[model samples]
Target: MKELTPVTIRPPFARYAHGVEIPAHWRIVQTSGQLGIRADDSIPEDAYAQAVICFEALSEILKSAGMTANDVAHISAYVTARDHMAGYMRARDTFMAHATRVPSSTLLIVSGFTRPEFKVEVEVLAAAP
Candidate 1:
C-alpha cells in the first residue's frame, strides 16, 4: 500500500490541506453522518457535549474499518448553530490529538438537522494501507 500525501498550493491556505492524494491500492471507507446520540439513545443538550459524542461515533466507525484517525483523509461537519463552531473545533481537536496527519475539512452551518435536538453531525472518509 502506498502512503497518502497532503497537497498544498503555492500560496498558503487555511489550517487544513487544500487536497489529499490517496494511494491506488489503499482501501477507502466513507462513513454515514453521525449524530450525538449516546449508548442509551439519549442526546446531549449542549453543543459541546453533542459534538464530543459525534466525534466519538466517527472514531468508532473508523475503528470498524480497520483505520484510525491518522488514516482520515477528509471530514465534513454540519452544525445547526453558528455559535457551536468553537465547541465543534474543540471536540475535533481532542479526537485528533494523536493524528499523524491532519485531514482536509469542511464545516457547514445549517438551519437544523433531521432531529432538532442534534446540534452537530460529522462524516468522515478514511483510507487504509
Candidate 2:
C-alpha cells in the first residue's frame, strides 16, 4: 500500500495518512465494525478500554485473513460522543504503532451503538500481495 500525502494539500491532523493506494493485484481484507464487548459480554466503562477491545478484535480479523495491521489501507471509526474521540484516537494509534506506514483514517461521532455502553466501534480495509 502507498500512503498518499501530497504536499499540495494540508497534512493529516493525526497519526494517519490522507489516503492510501493499493495495487489492483493485491488481496484485500475488510473487517466489520467491532464493538467493545468482551467474550464474557462485559463492557468497560471507559472509552479507552472499549476502543482497545475494538482494535484488538479488528487486528485478529486481519490476522485471520493472513494480513496484519501494516497491511491496512484505511480505517473507519465511530464514537458515541465527542468526548470519546481522544480515547478512540489513542487506541487507533496503538493499533497502527507497528505499521510500516499509517493508514488513512476517518472518525465519526454517532448517536450510539446497539448497546448504550458501547462507546466506540471500528472497522478497517487492508491489503496484501
Candidate 3:
C-alpha cells in the first residue's frame, strides 16, 4: 500500500519551484525572480549588467542548496529592452561558462517589470543528485 505525497519547494521561490512536489527522493531549489540590482542597491541599468547580476544571484541561491549551475534544469529570463538582446546573451553565456549542463531556457522581452529601473530578471530551476 503506497500513498502519494507532495513536496514543498518553498515560497517567494528563491529558484523556480512549484509548491507541489512528487513522490521521489530528489533535492530541488527554487529561486525567486532575480533582478539586476547589486548588493549595494544599484541596478546595472543595462541589459548586459542586469543579466550578469541576475545570474550571479541565481548562482548564490543554488550554492546555498549545495548545487551548481550544472544542476540547473531550466531557466526563464525576462528582458525589458529588446535592443539589448545581444548583450544579454553574451552576459548569460559568460556567466554559465562553468555550468555542468546547459539547461532548457526561455527568454522573453517585456514592457517592464515590478521595478521600472530594472533592465532584466531571471529565474532558474535546479534538480540535484
Candidate closest to the true structure, highest lDDT = 2
The candidate scoring highest on TM-score is 2
Rank the models by TM-score, top first.
Answer: 2, 1, 3
lDDT for each residue of candidate 2 in 1-129, tens digit (9 for 90 to 100):
889999999999999989999998999888889999998999999999999999889988988898889999999999989999999998898988998899999999999989888999999999999
TM-score of each candidate structure, all chains considered together:
0.88, 0.97, 0.77
Q: Which lDDT tens digits does candidate 3 get at residues 84-125? A: 777777877776778644555678999998878888888987
Clashing pairs in 2: none
Determine which window of 10 residues in candidate 1 has minimal summed lDDT.
Answer: 1-10
Position 45, candidate 3: lDDT: 63
RMSD of each: 2.8, 0.7, 8.9
Please give the clash total of every predicted structure, in order. 0, 0, 11
Off by over 4 Å in 3: 1-24
TM-score winner between 1 and 3, please give it: 1
Per-residue accuracy of model 1 over 36-121 as CA lDDT, tens digit each? 89999999898889989988888888888888888888889999888998898889888888987777789999999888899999
